[model samples]
Target: MEHPLSQFKYCPKCGSKHFNINNEKSKQCADCGFVYYFNPSSATVALILNDKKELLVCRRAKDPAKGTLDLPGGFIDMNETGEEGVAREVLEETGLKVKEAIYQFTLPNIYVYSGFPVHTLDMFFLCQVEETSHISAMDDAADAFFIPLTEIRPEDFGLGSIRQGLVKFLSALK
Candidate 1:
């Protein structure tokens, strides 16, 4: 609801409001002459389904997607392979240890930092959680649970990422 950097009156380095909003996050500084573009990182996610055919979902607490439903995921850290990132993200966000990975697709997504070139690649997979018996919500999730596939709708999805993944996944099932 609020901009992450809305409180700054000046740049931390130069102390000037010479930077104007390119949309919500980006700025072109007329005074300090700096290119402070916030580029996005690659993110990976897994769509988990239990024996009951319910789909696992998480409520996001951080931005780029706060207060939305999402498959467990986050930034892909440096030196981490795409599979490694997906594995780590699932454990960090859902406390579920995933041992198997099936690369589904890689999507190039563009979103306005508020409305400006914040582009990121979102990688998705369908994973089988190894430790379902010990599953719990971890870092970024306010809550986590399994919802029946019929219950998943556009609003239940955090963004186009999960929705797109789910559509393909369900279609394949048919």
Candidate 2:
């Protein structure tokens, strides 16, 4: 619990470690008067299925959870619709465009980012892309490939979160 990123720091008014996370959007120090609110990031991800029913996964190249296999997704820029975000993420992470996308699920997740408390409200969609088109990895990805859903395992994932998402998505299919 003693990490530089815990979001817990001296209130300056009265140094205290008692911080509350239940605040509507801000954490107020129980002692002094320090307010901290996480800036929740909005993200959109695309679950693309090919003709063989294989799902496309990308190996991440960035941090927070680097070197992991994940769905095509990224932060949603201001004023951007979920559709636009997902489409852009897919295009950016993989050199392929989704032809159609259908809403699937939403998840509110929190994780430590660079030792800072951060949260994410992720919107997911099932997408269909060109089946025979050449697949290639682009931004924020080291590589990508279409693999059978059953072949994905936690050990194969570079990040635990993406592995969990894949597991959940696969479970929903069953």
Candidate closest to the true structure, highest TM-score: 2
The per-prediction CA RMSD against the true structure, in angstroms, equals 5.2, 4.6
The model with the greatest lDDT is 1
Estimate TM-scores for all models.
0.70, 0.75
Residue-level lDDT tens digits of model 2 in 1-174: 433335455454566767655455666787766786556688877888877788888887877678767778888999998888888888888878878878887787655667664577778889877653777788888888888877867567654455667777889899
Return model 2's CA RMSD, one decimal: 4.6
lDDT, each prediction? 0.76, 0.74
TM-score of 2: 0.75
lDDT (10s digit) by residue, model 1, range 115-138: 443467888888888756666777
Give the poorly placed runs of model 2, Cα more than 4 Å off.
Answer: 1-24, 27-39
Q: Which residue pairs in model 2 clash with each other? A: 5-115, 27-36
